[model samples]
Target: MTDTLIQTLDVALGERSYDIVIGPGLLGSLSQHIETVSPTARIAIITDETVYELHGQAIEQALAGRQTHIIIRPAGEAQKSLANLEDILDSLFRAGFDRSDLLIAFGGGVIGDLAGFAASIYKRGMPFIQVPTTLLSQVDSSVGGKTAINNQFGKNLIGAFYQPQKVVTDTDLLKTLPARQLKAGYAEVLKYGLLGDPAFFDALEAGLGQDILDLDEAALTKAIHVSCATKAKIVAQDEREGGVRALLNLGHTFGHALELEAGYDGDLLHGEAVSVGMEMAFRFAVEQGLCPVADADRVSAHLAATDMPRISDMTHLLHDPAALLKHMGQDKKNESGHLTLILPRKIGETFIEKRADREAVLRFLTQLRDEA
Candidate 1:
């Protein structure tokens, strides 16, 4: 249980395999991960306003001797937009970023997602490192190379599975994060347990206490390392979300819909959405006879213990179930005119299912508002 630091490796396909560094004091060691694969022209650190305040200069200072520019956008999920991309590109150009310039994501999932997307498309793909500061990003978003932005359609609608050169997980940075954000980020951490490994969930449940107000370096590092390894295996087999990787989306289908309805406001953090989404997915599966009601309840209890949102509160985001369903239909994961659902067959086990009937989904939505 006293895992202060650990070195783990994940093999991503296409000549892009890399190691994940997890431990305390990682923020200070970020420079080690920034690869000079080729001659680099410049460096750009893209993060949101909030993250920059926390470790912007620390990261920039890590690359201090190099040519670096920092792009700090206003904090919010809505910031992930074509407009923001354009602004970031402008900043990169102003900072003299060329074909070989590097981009490092120094925030939670949103910033990591945005920075990765920017790196992938800029000048026909540039180098980028994931310096994920939040537990959610460290464990989930920053590891997989899945970069994206949102739109009128839904969350992460526009994105690519572009892998990062290195994932720098500094658990130290998490200590300064607000408790609410910390709890919200743990949703994704718990996700690895929900989808693939039940043991990790048990560890998280036992380790995460009400007084987790301060970061326990050992606990945080273990969670991040395990989740990253899980993602690495899934990504290795199916880097483009072909099959096994879809398992990672256990709560995302339902979660993304809620985030869009909330307009990516600070009100619904990504981890919060996923936590509730995972619960809803399980509960909906139980409703459809795909799983037991007890399974759904257990999922709810785990999320609640971590201070995550509840699926029963879906109605709070909106009044009409049809509207939410409509949003779900627009999800990128949907296929062949039928929405896909990642449902849990039981607690600690989930899978992607396409058998969810439309009426059943709508009926559930009609009741979501009441729960909200």
Candidate 2:
């Protein structure tokens, strides 16, 4: 018999109430959640090539006992594009999906964002569930109901505020994730700590490792629970990226710009960019005297231990520090011609700011030159 543990998080929206189910072998329970929201109807499960190869058949078999549509795309951030979104729509159309039919985002953050964005626009809106298969998606992207897609303008520039019917995260699926992906996801997991809750940071610092990667059931569940709960609390306060919701973009502005600079062709994953971005945010904070130098060093060391990128590496990516500032100025999180950069006062403590000067920003990026 397969063991399972399910967690139900109430996002606090009365009519739009959702649940986050976490378990050891919860994928098999996908049908149960579907039934909770849907009354034995047709559905489509959208995923990527990587996930499909690892989990497609099992998911299909579990749900094949009923009407189902399984849509697959090439795996990676590149697949979260208009072309793939179009293909997913075509597949849904071919499957005769209607307003009543459901769309299931059945992979990592990329698949969840793409599939959720498609669901948001299909016939205006439809109820879909976030079956996140990655640590990043489960903790941050999947639960917040902020569905978006990247365009030439920027990452997640074009999207919606559509919430999922539910989110089912299976820890068992994570067992197969590559180490790089695991660490990338770990970066987001650590964000919850770096964002709030110092003890969580201590826990991650103590136990997140290679041995823990394959499957430390206790650690994995706690990580998912805390990350989702953090997002859930923030989303409850600001579901539309208005107030504290912007805090969630802690490392994203620089992160997205780096992805665009690299052309988003899987050369650098989203989490990789954010890993470096967080490092930059801290460095910028220290250089601007916004926080203590020791705090900034601590942030970089923790990130390095996780094998994430750093500020010096970023200076190499963009030769012109002015250009990076320009890219950051264009971030969606910005307000009133000011950048909403989330800087760390110390690990386990971060807050959004609109007071840092542009010249100081240059000083920070320039500081990396000396380190490199």
Candidate 3:
């Protein structure tokens, strides 16, 4: 629980494996890690305006003597687009950065995704590091090799599985995060528990949830470590989501649909959408006889207790079940025109239902809309 305590977890991918270093005040030691991974590589730090303003000086001081270029974009989910990716690539080319150079994604999920995608395709390929500042990015996006940019069709429609050279998560940076964003990130933390660890879920329900939301050092660190450890194990087992990795998308199918309906206009944060989506997943499972009503109620109760978003809180965006269904149809998980959903058989137990009945999904949405 001390600020000096650091925990390291590895995503074992044979030749591509890397370590995720988690601790408070990690930025101070970032340069050493970077040097170890890309000692002779020139650096390009890609960050959004907000993050740069908040912690730019610290990062600059950390890598003081290293050759580096800073690229700062406007902060928001909207920035994760093809246009921005092109702009970043252009900047890298203009700066004469090459495959041997290093790129650092120095913000939340958006920056991580955009910069990561750029690194993936820049001159065939380039090594990159993730210095994720936000809680959401630290625990989830930063650990996975899934880098992407959004298109008009849907979220992360264009992307590649490009692993980073390293991930440095400084928990201290989270002190500046808005309460809402922090809560949003906690949704992903809750997710690892809901998806596979019942004991973790129980711990959350028993006050660990509030401890994390309150930013208690020990609690927050434990949550982050456990979430990343769970994800690392899964990614190592299935690097490209070929099989078990799909379980990580437990609430994402429904969540991404809600996000599309919200127009990605910042109205609904990704974690918030996932919060509601997870509840919906549990309820839908009950409807399908895959789970019990009691399990569904527990899921809802936990979200409500923690003040996380639920279906009732997002009624305005849930007005049209048909439209939501349309968005769901576009989910990347679909195969052969059949809906692929990650549904729960119970808390801590989830399975990929690749052949989900489309009409059944529609009816489920309709029922949710009516209730809302």
Candidate 4:
């Protein structure tokens, strides 16, 4: 994982295939990467205020001789809205951007999702690239091409599966990330292990300190590389969450509900909500005798050890069980009006349960509320 030992993982979608470059000092090579896809194209950089402040000059210097238009907006989950998406599209139009121009998403998950969604609809789709600055975006959201914005009803209720031309993940950018943001991002890294690789989970548990929390070069590199590969394989097979892809939502069913309950405010980050929701999923699975109570406890202990939030931490900010259940019903993963959820059978193994009972979920939510 030396600065020079870069890794390139490809998402093989035949005609739409693209490479995800994982390494350090990649922003300087931005123009070189773009030239391969849209040569002679101007760049429209969409970033939040924070990322623009941190990497604006570096990006400018990288695309030094190229024509670039910068659009800086407010940062946070709340910023992912129809209004903001409209603003971004308006900005691109004002710059007279055409089909050949490139849209670069240069922030964390929110900015990436918003900008990519904008790129997807602007003039019937244009090329977009991801320069994910946060650990969460690098390992999960950015790699999957799941662009989205939030609505009054639910999280990601509006979005598109628009792939990016390239994904540049410079792990060095993570060094300046706040400890909470880093820990939040680790939740997604842990998801791969929880969903399909027990050995990977074991490795993470044993090396939680240096490998994960501390962002050790080799460890972090391996985590991002493997996570991207896992996602690429699943997306290649399922593309649009028809079947196997749903397993990736192991914690998201409960997580999205929590996000809606919080009103997409900073009070609960997407990853932290997923961490708590994963804990709830396992605990619920045990309640239904689908998984062992011991297994559920072990998963909770691991997340807790990483300083992640427990279900109780954010439960007080939410409503009653019925209201939360209503939110879960509106998730996009549902089919035929059934409440679908990705539940774990054990560590490194999970399944989709469309038969998940609403009453059962209500009971579980009530139990969690009481404990909280």
Candidate 5:
């Protein structure tokens, strides 16, 4: 691979800033990158069983001479819990890891969240690198420092704003993803365009969607680069999600509620939920007369082409509007006892509405339930 295939985007958070390197076949050079951050730090790789099986040998070969330990967990959203977090911490402690060692998150979003959370609490804080293997993690979760495990209360409720020392996103790894998984991640890529870049969305709708799903090298690299750049800019501006950062959660409020309702099972992937949530946000906006019906229709049409689940697809599993409303209320973005929702007025225009009315929200959700 030529150097041109690898693209690097920087997340500028002053002293906590790091580089997100996007490319295919970049894993072989991972050790060289980590050495730049911590030349002699021992390595603790946190990955799921499936990923480790597929890519563990490559990782082992990459760090041939280094002192490395591998900690594997079962792969699934349900695995992102306090129990798993505690087990990882205990295992790392037993492995003789300390503050100076590094934790390498080498899987999808779930592993990244779990390992990042563990790194944050272990020894009060430890340096870590994000080797995001999944497209979703590469574009969103891996770049940002927001790491957390899910609790009974909500998703990502028990987490911290901890940045990684470096992020290595090898696009080559994405080739192994199942079609469903790739589509789920594509939802996030589509989100970047929907939230802030209409041109990107236009391109996706115009045929870039197929290129991305097909894993065309140039198209895949470009998509991941732009997505990371968007995320990096947002994280730099609002490290703890106090302002414009809320825009990144455009579809999360509604989507997360649905995920919670589905019990985070294989029934609804995070990105799938977000895809449906984005549609719901636009649909709700149109219903309130806050967004033009044309724009909402366009958004739905583009996402529909990607084959992501629509609100109606999961409506059968969700019959109680009040229950979903309760989950939305638990969103970390809520402020002053009011639910803060990210609503889109157009393709590239979105705003945070902090005074979301609970009764009105319930009414809208009831209408959606009726459609089922």
Candidate 6:
């Protein structure tokens, strides 16, 4: 709660710009922040059951007397569905909420995406705030304004780019996160480094990575700030993802295919799949002679040293290269019926290959399966 500890970064979107406030115990002063954005507007909070069970009372206390409506749903990646979206819309409509009111996405990425997407379309765009609780949500999803829900075809195919009015990131909440979930989120933290900053990657390789996994307050804070700052900068330059913003999805194409194969059943988390996908990207790059084997080996080594999920960890789906390739073909990044992959040139650098050879990718997948 120390004023000196709190840091705020801005996502510069001209008039739609918003602040991402990071620190511990910021939730204690949530009401004041809410007042600044939507003082007279009614508040509707959408969160998952798990998060509500842990922090429900604190949230109620934070918003003490603000005409609040609490909507809780069962927690899981599976919950990010069209059915849940409809249910949320019905609840908002039944509650008589209007476009001028404020909607708060009060959980991890699932709730944030669902609620933010709901807010974006409801009554032609109601204002919303992001109060992301998970490490993945805090560093990545919450700041980007790329709200979405999953579908049968792929993950996050149905959604919108609707920025939140404010993002309240309380690092303290991560204390209650299960270790597995925390590690899953760390995959995203690692991603910021892998995709762009070599210095950040070097720091992670040194000891900052373990410090973050250990939940060291200083390390966690710094990583979150850097990740958000990186994402915010990209989003500003390419608000609609016409250019640089796609860099943010370095491993998502392959990762989403893995998620699709897993059926959004909570068995394979987005970040976990992303960890494997990043490794695949590097290996794929090496196979294509675009990057050095040393770079790919280093990426694999770092992921293994951190105890992250790897391609080997997903042997169950490895047998079907055709299926995985089919999923990849449907990736949102694909254009003109061609596969688009984000491949690494080296550590701390990546490029979007728009016309990824379908057969080459299949051969690579077959090789992974054979090796597994």
TM-score on alpha carbons, each prediction: 0.93, 0.94, 0.98, 0.98, 0.98, 0.99
Give me the candidate number with maximum lDDT.
3
Question: 171-199 in candidate 3: lDDT tens per residue?
Answer: 99999999989988989999999999999
User: What number of backbone clashes does candidate 4 have, counting pairs of residues 3 or more apart or in separate chains?
Assistant: 0
What digit string (tens of lDDT, one per residue) describes model 4 on residues 1-372?
A: 355558999999888889999988888888888887788558999998889888889899989999999999988999989998999999999999997789999999999999999999999999999999999999999987788999989999899999999999988889888998998899899999999999888888887533668878778888999899999999999888889989888789888898888888798899998898898899999999999888898898887777787786875755488888999999999988999999999998899998799889999898777776
**lDDT (tens digit, per residue) of candidate 5 on 29-120:** 99899987887648999999889999999999999999999999999998899988999999999999989889999999999999999999
Q: Give the TM-score of candidate 4.
A: 0.98
What would the per-residue lDDT of candidate 2 be over residues 294-316, giving only the tens digit for each residue? 86777777777766666656666
lDDT of each: 0.77, 0.79, 0.92, 0.88, 0.91, 0.91
Off by over 4 Å in 1: 1-4, 35-41, 208-214, 312-314, 370-372
Compared with the true structure, what per-residue lDDT tens digits does model 6 show for residues 317-347?
7889999999998887888998988888988
Instruction: Give the least accurate 10-residue stretch of model 3, judged by summed lDDT.
Output: 1-10
Runs with alpha carbons beyond 4 Å of true place in candidate 5? none
Candidate 3 steric clashes: 0
**Predicted structure 5, TM vs. truth:** 0.98
TM-score of 3: 0.98
Compare candidates 1 and 2 on TM-score and give the better one.
2
**Per-candidate clash tally:** 3, 0, 0, 0, 0, 0
In model 5, where is the ten-residue run with the lowest total lDDT? 309-318
What TM-score would you give candidate 1 relative to the actual structure?
0.93
Give the candidate order by descending TM-score: 6, 5, 3, 4, 2, 1
